[model samples]
Target: MVRCVVQSQWLIYSKHLPSISTAKRHSIQAFPLFAISGRGSSSHTLSADDNAKPLLMGPLDNVMPRHHITPKALFIPASSSSKEKILKILKSGLAQTIKAIPTVAGHVKAASNPIQEGSMCVTTPFGAVEDIFTAQDLTESHPEMDYDDLKRRHFPMEAVDSNVVYSLPDLMKAEKPVFLAQANFIRGGLVLGISLHHSFGDGTSLKTILQTWATCCRGESAAPTLTESTRRERLMSSETGASLDEFPEYATIPDNIAGYQPGVAKGEGPEIAPEPPQVDSHVFYLSAQRLKGLKDLASAKLEGSDWISTSDALSALLWRSITVARNLEPGDAATEDTRVLNIPLDGRRIMREDTNSYMGNMILFNNATTPLRNLLSSPPQLPEIARTIRQSISRIDEKYIKRAISAIGSVPDVSKVIMSGGTFGESALTISSWGNLHMDWGHVIGGPSERVRVSKIPFPGVCVILPASEPGNRSTEPNGVEVMIGLKSDDMARLMNDPFFASFAEWRCS
Candidate 1:
């Protein structure tokens, strides 16, 4: 099934631009140029040949608005000497990367058959570049804030101005640029902002492209392994199994034959109450200590069940905490049943396919539900809540993923019809984890002198969980997981006031 995944990144930080006592003065220059799509791959370059043409949107991409964009960012501290060279590499290699991942170089267009398949086509894709600002200007622009505060200010919580960078000309505005980038020189550091349409791909796809770009920037000759061989046709062909009725709508089931029932169905469920009009974004982190306590709490109640992951426990905790913040009553069965945790699981490594090099959206949601009363019980049943999430995730095995892929492929407008459920209703939460995405790997610029120290990204209305380095495992410690959430003003106020919720994270509100 075609999945239209949107992603973006906006990072604000200066490499080696700390206190004068710690940072040396460095000169900065800018190279802002749009990188056109290339046509071949070789040492120091990537080119598209077969899949280079305008590609049709997949079932996944059909769900969201064709014009919608997702923004994200990265912070890299580099030396003054290597900064120019780095930008040169990026400018030169951008074409190569696009050639390898043609979708990123393409833009959306009106599809001939909108009803049978998706309505947009990603055509003539290209990358746009812009110099945002220098480190001194970035610091001067917001002098009231501290270093950390400045980083938060530059985080891309929403869509950026595509026109300022790699936007298509009015005459050629057939579709959104599959990708747009902006480079901000932070004294001796650099911040890169990239925005992608939701229909293009998911986090995995974006990361894959970036990693490949990094490889090319470092002068690697290896071309990205595009596994579009026979799989492309399988995901696009009309199939009966992709029917919304046959598959569990709003939520997914472990097996098609099991017939497990969820609380809601596609286009047949009650609408969730409207969300509060005003909303704000906040970022919080779960330290190793608090995370350990949470895992222990969840495990305490497992009673010899299969192991639960840190992700499961945290999701349950957040679900429980949000329910409490909403002041949900402990005894309302109807209110309780609607509360759900929409956790998306990646299907790349699993299914035993060497699809690690594969791009586009490859994800399935595990919608776990529990009543408010059970979650907010006298002592709070953390384990049971965690178990529910674990079970839901467990159901996403080879059989389930294969079925989901087929199911997504079956529907022409899969996003609109299948899983048409709303998160606004019933206090539902959707969480995306970047802990395993390896975003920090090869995220260096110029030389190895300075690396990407931190990244600030939040899913405006949803939740994003990122990982830090593990304990004793210093290698991954820098990549520790942090949760970024955007909530209504009222919800944010309550969430911050709740000591229990506040204790687990440092609430950095924006």
Candidate 2:
């Protein structure tokens, strides 16, 4: 039976934890009336008093993103409004919609309860936005650089505005790159940048938030309602009093990843993205049926289990594709050392399905690969990649999520994670899918209602985000998952049309 815990808001707050440690730290351990098993079945009783410890942390603490790549360019075309009008709209919208810009940790440090400015968008007492823009970047030219190179680096929750301070309430928020100009009135070229935080939601969520602001600008009503649009929940349960015990006060992070290096030198960073013909967005399709077909084909050739998540399945496909494109032996990507495949896991599952709309970011978990030797030494096949990925994913239990929830505090400095993932490198590639583009921004903006649109900014060599135009209702579009992958000019040129990636018909038709 499909077992899901239903929680009350009080339990959520009461269960909020500051840290997660794998070492059983709690001095309490009492088995409840029901037994607990690894699988979700009624036969395996997960009673209220059992020692479940924590398979997952609070909602926000578990969904923090590992590969947060800023796109080389984020083009926001103010097609209808004057530049000045757009700038005013942006500032006012930002102020009204959020208390502050998001950061890697999902925290938005605000002043006292009654904001001194009385505006949701906070400004530093000295007249700067919260961690808005840095002192160095405020100068003219703001250091001309390449967009692709810096795409992988994490930005402080501060704004590109330069007047903000710092701190996280608990989680981060993923915000889209905003366009602001010196002369809000002038029709000169646009300048692009984003407030560093926003790992809490998917790219589509950010786009919807921006479109929500656009609607606010027009004094129009937003569709789906904010309460309905943004849902949230904490994964840990104190239900029936909870069978799992409290977390160990000081649990250590799993260092099981053989060559897992936390921080790496920024060899190159992404600068600016190219201006597009128009701000074109559409829902791409990746069907469940197609996925099933592929899985069947792979299963015939390779003996692997059918119980696998869609993400693990697709990632295996992409990994196989990349290795093929590179023509490296599966072992080749591995040095005499281990090779890592950085996978980003969403945190929506951690939250209660009934909850909605949050101001900060959530915790993100990654299923990193084992050493190169292991991957290379094993049987070679695309499905095998899937199997390995499945194995890796299996290790990302609630304990690891708990550790990640506490990772923000571990930021040695700069309020960033120490992990050095290849988000901006040409070799790094990411794939993501939003189950279904269930909401529509056009409807909110008072336009003809239609499918929604979203993006995953390109950084991790090749970035992909999938959002279904319809949830399980396949008639709208089966396997209609929007995949948005960004590649530097050459990389895109090489792999854009390869068999591994095909633009969704929804995207093409739109």
Candidate 3:
């Protein structure tokens, strides 16, 4: 039997909040159904003011815009100190933090020369891009949503530029660092908004910077080891060796995909990705006990060298449960053989480099598919599902990473390659796991600091599995995983109620 719990309570709004003048104020949109989890007499804001000139960006930073200036927020539950004290620490830390991560303090500019044959080539010479730092205070602008409400809210809907699918051309032309941060105080906690362009850095890069900032807030002496120079040196080095096999033939274009002719006008994209379907975002917690049970189930079904992992079990369960929720089975002609999962696998380990060494976008999308009919009719074949996902990721070995580098080098505009790489829709699910990122370094704010309870990308239509570590067991035994899923309003409504899914995860839906 499955147990399902639902909560639908509306929260009150605070018309005004106290002021923290160190940070610039920016209006933030209000959200529905929120509550204040802790007690705070007043609210305030603080901005990071760094006046350094914008720095020129490398070719590696110009390829994909999918991650351009993203709004990523972390919920910091109220601490023992007053909100003002905490804000002051964050403000002071920002100054030091921005100085350390120079790239985030600059902006991206395009090539000045309009025409050159190899100009579009990533390895070819290009013009310089500018950069700078900016900050905002969103405390007064947005409606006060409870920490739990924020957790259940569809992150993409609340995120800035949630509709963007690929390439932030506007940000590039402006020659500004594809980064911004907004700080807001809720009733019982604080939401630290960190935004960075994909061109500036990847998830790993962001995590390093945030953790370092946290370290600084705690008055510790920790220097950032990752730098933009590291990324440039690795990519331009001949050692990577231009290998053709690295390119996935199916994912690449036969010719110029973005239609870039060196002498011609820059091509225009499809503008903003069509507004995502009206969707509801939900958060599901997988307790350690339930996590082991699912993995055990998968392991019990496997034989010989074939085995299942914790990730595999979770992925399989989500795929099957979603399929069942949609009622897409054998007799359902419209939905048979339509389920597909896109997993973004990190390539640093496969490339034989220190996994923690370089902070840049080093990942590839691996797609796995199983017919809906097969998934629905197969008598509890989760092991098979787990195996398919495992194989998909395992295939992205050293050879694949090298080929990807070669393919990226050949492309004039990499965004084209990224867009054409996979599918995204109701029938499709793209899951990116940051569980291993180890963001537990956020315990640097005050005396006896609390580690970041919830860290999320808040993008719509996609699922991001972030770290959920207990106070002390982070290094050894992680508490569990927090899965943030976005689906169309009707689809999400049904999915959260699906009995099979409810059996494993604890869900809170709005």
The candidate that achieves the highest lDDT relative to the unseen native structure = 1
Q: Write model 3 residue lDDT over 207-295, tens digit each, in one string.
A: 67777667777777556453332234343222244432333322322333243344442322222332334556666778788889989
Sequence-dependent TM-score of model 3? 0.71
lDDT of 1: 0.50
Across residues 171-265, which tens digit of lDDT does each residue of candidate 2 receive?
A: 23322222111211112223233332232344444544555544555555544334223222222232233211222112222333333234532
- The C-alpha TM-scores of every prediction are 0.72, 0.46, 0.71
lDDT of 2 at 438: 32
Instruction: Residues 1-510, candidate 1: write the lDDT tens digits.
Output: 111112222111111111121121111111111111112211122344445455655554544344433455455554444556666777656656655665666655556544433345665434343321111124344334232434544333332223322322233244456666666554445556555555566667766667666677667743535424112332332222333343332322122212222432321222222223455666676777788878888887456548898888898778877777666455655552556666666666564545555455555656676776777776778888888888877877766665555555454333233242232342546666762433332343543211122232222235667665222356654434567776666777787887777767665434
Best by TM-score: 1
lDDT (Cα, 0-100) at 383 in candidate 2: 61
> How accurate locally, in lDDT, is each candidate?
0.50, 0.33, 0.48
Error of 2 at 284 (Å): 8.3
